[model samples]
Target chain A: MKRNILLLLVIFVGIGFLLHAWPSFSQEGEEEAGYPTYPIIFTKPLKAVLFDHKVHVEKAGLSCEDCHEDIFKMEAGSTQQNEDFNMDSLYKGKYCGVCHNGEMAFASNTRCASCHIGVMGYERLLKKQHSSESSSEH
Target chain B: MFKGFADWVKSLKNEGVEHIASEERRAFLKLGLVITGVYAGGKLLSVVSRVREVYADIPEYVDKYPYKPHYSMVLRTDRCIDCQLCMEACRKTNHVPPYGWRTRILEQHLPSGEGQWTRRFMPILCNHCNEPPCVRACPTRATYKDPETGIVKVNVKKCIGCKTCMAACPYDMRYFNEEKRAIDKCDFCWESRLSKGKFPTACAKACPAGVRIFGDLADPNSRVYQLVHDPYRAIWVLRPSMGARPNVFYTIN
Candidate 1:
């Protein structure tokens, strides 16, 4: 009876280990769900209006899969922001710079005052310039 | 005493004849006691080991979110193309490497006897349950649900990436990010988008079939809440009887 009980215990543990056989299982599932968010850094002056993707999706009679297209359906915080977002390079069509370069999506040069107005997180850029001007004035 | 000890072991080894002859009716009690003592000792050792586990990867998020029986994304079966756009969209939105898929659309072809083509499409992702089993299996506090949004999230930065939550999950929703050596899964796009003042997951946003709907499950005015509350709508979850009490709802046509 004692040996049988030990064997039963061993079976339970064996089942548990078998149940958790895949080491990459949970993480693969988690990654599929969305785990970590890779940080993005900007190397160029390419800030757009805070596009509330939800407004167009839920309230505006649009589906969630529209504006996001292909890229929006990616993992969280994994977007590459530092990719060169310039107009000359963008005009040829690359990243957000390509279409937003003025012809296809939105104009890059024509929107200086748009993002530069401060609501687009470019206020920090302006503040730095302003402080530099004041300091050089002295 | 040493001679006596050797004699006892020798007797046990040669037990076929002498042991059987020596055994009496009362020997059963002695065997029973031995078995119970062994069992008790094992239990004590296991409890101690569990208590002393330093880097146990348990879920610390069970105490975080309040329970709810509704979910956000609803699978509209009739509109599904089995294209797996949602799965691709989720990867794009999250930048998930090709190691594994977080969301997948399952296709089932009916036997060709009905004189009509019937392909069943099932889009599966984490159901963000009111009581997620993955939350219990984690020995470390890596997996947890968000309080404000009620979405399940893992602290990938802190996770040792143990597969405990995967075992604990009845829906088999949890996944691992082998590249980062951590766990990953759906946060309903709420943790990254909604809570961060944005909205629409990549899967929900890029859904060409318009089969998936992402909304706040909390507010009555939210599209997801309305969908969940719809009396005529038939909502379903994977293994609804498992008692995980998931918040995700689906409209299977």
Candidate 2:
């Protein structure tokens, strides 16, 4: 009976230990599970050509730079974003900054939905994902 | 009585050590099986999701939506006229920064039969591979393949800028973005328009000739899918010998 009680205690102790770790694990989120980012968002309304990353990459001979315009150099998960409150000042003559101007993605247009649509949402999603992801790890 | 107690204590100590050693040995064996079990389990889950699925570690580090290729870049080699308008258009449309030529035109010099020298231009970009080498070589789990759309992409967040994927690639398509410090390759244009349920790449739209076609490979209704599957044609991917098994199928005449 004593041995059985000790085994029961061990099981309960293990369960308690894991249960204690549950909330923290849940808090880690899924997107933050070791993902990289380039946080530089376009302050200007980038209303140029809508490009599909998967098709051109697979069907056409174009690589990433073929269109993203060397906004930043190709590094492993490079994320060097400058804080430019406006669009023209942010990307002018700097990679896509030259072409996307009001005419392209480098426009001086200022609309929260236009400039921050995909970027802001995507960034938030990544963060939320990561939090849940870290939790699931344990 | 003291001697007897001492002997009893010594016996307990010996038994404890023996028990610990056996437990450790058993634990070592259990560890091997546990690791194997995890790997097998992960593989099975991924396979069930169609081998293209990612096997995430405990951290769920796998991207929720891995890259899905969405565009087909085609150059009218004959209509190119060597003008490089396409190049400028691509650069302007996409912001392909300086010194990093994303669309490199291959000028094939042809000695005109009439003694007039002619050049045929072939624009080359990242050949999004079916079995992408860049995706395979990333150590930090930065590069990934989107099973839904067949697009291989890099997670700028996780990439350490090691350039292993660049070196691993065969077509020399992968570019190292020095400023941001990550290996850059084509992921269609999902990064910019991912939230809109849209599928368009800058290069495909910039072409005035309407030569480029972008679509889903899995969907038989897609133009590219029908084109690639056409039995009465000869289409080719760059460097088939590289074993990278690229998805970019160029219909060469």
Candidate 3:
């Protein structure tokens, strides 16, 4: 009877561990399904800017059809290749300015560091990526 | 007896300012002075206080521009995008090592609303303060502020490398250069670009955003002067309470 109690305790702890790690497991599943779960960092014309698909989709309640192939192409970083991908273009109601026109969202001119993460943010992101990769290797 | 005296004073008629003529009040108001209170019972002692309009950051001494050129920089803080092109130019021009930085960008996450935060990037460099604490801390007399151009410079040969200036610096702009065997900092590109007949510093020239406006503060026509002197724009300096009297100014367009 003592041996059976020990097995039951082990099962309880195992179930607790899985419960704690359930969110990360679901995130991994999303990544595997080509959901663009990771943040897309753009580097062109300037050092960096950040775009989060999860924030747009889940938080802002935007569907894939709203932006995909209409506002932005399906492939990431492709828009940056064009010559008019700079801030002047944004002010003229192009790219991010399409929605961020002071009505739907905050104007692109204001809250600069929100989108333009700058070189420091770029370096921090690189460091995070390196650490995560090294931890995965172990 | 003192209590009886106080009671007698209280019982006396309290003559209000109705006797004072409106013309006298109007004259005082025109001179930007207000007669706040009358202390000596009558109009004999009127506390006329001057209503002086003063910007806290712009000190009275700045109007003199002690140095001839009075080299200064006005930063449009809002325009800074943190691309780090200025930093790269400074590194290339000054030969700053990978570990060391002449200028740096700091990030701040300020709360915008409920559960939301806004990011701001602040770029910092040597302010070349009028009363530099680093110059005061140096034991070897290695660093000195130039009287002609007002640029605080270092004489590397005289430097003892004691690192006291590094500790004394309010802005944390100085670093020990392993190659030079002395403390190095941003000289506003004096040694690299300015001394070579170049108009503006490398960092200022390299910035694509036109954030750093470098010019003589003494000159009325210069962009730096106009930006700082503008009444509408709010101008401020970092660590003004330190009493450094920083030449570098920050404003938003």
Candidate 4:
């Protein structure tokens, strides 16, 4: 009976890890109702560049197909690993510059503070997420 | 020997070139010509004198401002993300066609250390210069500067589509609009929005970064005025040598 309890504990811990690791996959169905308020964080050139999907889609009136399969991939954090994933790429009319250019949107070069969010904004988001997670557990 | 030295000094002073009459010296001074650099007759001097004549009527820069509501734009160039929201807003507000753009962003790259690179973006549009070349070049007076607001506006009714304004623009901002059959460029959104009581231009309103600060330069409280007038800020305009005296200013900060 002791062996059985240990096995169950291990199984519960593994499941918890899986849920935490893949929040997007687990929360996909729920987020559909909320619609595009998700903040995507990128770690490059420095940690925590926040891209708000809600502002682009809901406020700016852009569709999913507008960015997907063209400028960026559907998978999150995939572009960060690419060799040309930095500001250089964006300036060349790739990535975010595809829309952010003054011709299409606000040029990426003009507003460094708005979307850069920086490491501080990243930490704040992380803290908010941690507190929410702990509170939810309680 | 002392008497001989004094006599020699007096003789040297007497031998000096004849002094000009005081009235002649006063007349030269009145012409604002310094003697050291002045040559009475030369082709270059004639050209310089004619150029001075052309500008002599113009008032000092500080006192030359004629517009009451001097519409101006200050661009914070470093913060641009190159999102095209402003472009879309312009098109929607002004009905700009697919082939034409009133404003555009230019990208430049500089190599940082460790094989990394830095990207910079600059947005360009009609500068609406105080001495607009486009307005002066237009034969039909199709493009003219609004005296009250200091905005360069295209009178489509008067435009013959000679494209003189397009060629004359140092910024290359004007384009011959096929639909309008006139050279169209940015008018600070005067007809579409400004005249309709909107404060910010379409592009400025759509800019998420607050990169484009648009306001009246005459207003001391306006951000545009503050940014342009700030001593700490490195403010500059494009191609200042062209003598456009652009109302639009750019700042790195």
- Per-candidate TM-scores read 0.45, 0.43, 0.75, 0.53
lDDT of each: 0.56, 0.52, 0.83, 0.76
Tens-place lDDT digits, model 4, residues B1-253 = 9999767544442221124455754565567542322122211121112223222123433335578788989888877656656787898999898989898877656676988666666778899999999999999998899989999999999999998888889999988889998888999999999999997999999986678999988887888777766655667778878998888888786
Measured as a fraction from 0 to 1, the native contacts recovered by model 1 come to 0.00
DockQ of 2: 0.01
When 3 and 4 are scored with lDDT, the better candidate is 3
**Which candidate leads in DockQ?**
3
| Order of quality (lDDT) | 3, 4, 1, 2
Q: What is the C-alpha RMSD of each candidate to the true structure, in Å?
A: 29.6, 29.4, 9.6, 19.6
Interface RMSD of each: 19.6, 17.4, 1.1, 7.9
Better by lDDT, candidate 2 or 1? 1
For B91-186, candidate 2 gives per-residue lDDT tens digits of 665556666655665645567688665444455677776677788788998888776666677787888988888788786766777776776666
Model 3 segments more than 4 A misplaced:
A1-35, A58-61, A133-138, B1-62
Tell me the interface RMSD of model 4, in angstroms.
7.9
Question: Across residues B102-175, which tens digit of lDDT does each residue of candidate 3 receive?
Answer: 88878878787999887877789999999999999999899999989999999999999999999999999999
Candidate 3 docks with a DockQ of 0.58
lDDT of 4 by residue, A1-138 (tens): 999999999999998887666655646753774544456888764555788777887789988888887877877767777888877678888999888788988886665756665444567789988886775553
Worst 10 residues of 1 chain B by lDDT: B45-54
DockQ of each: 0.01, 0.01, 0.58, 0.10
lDDT of 1 by residue, B1-253 (tens): 9999767544442212222222431353333311111122222111112211111112421122243423366666555544455676677777678877677766555554777544455677888877778877777878886665667889887788879898888767777888878988887765556657666777877765567887756556777666655655555556766777666556643
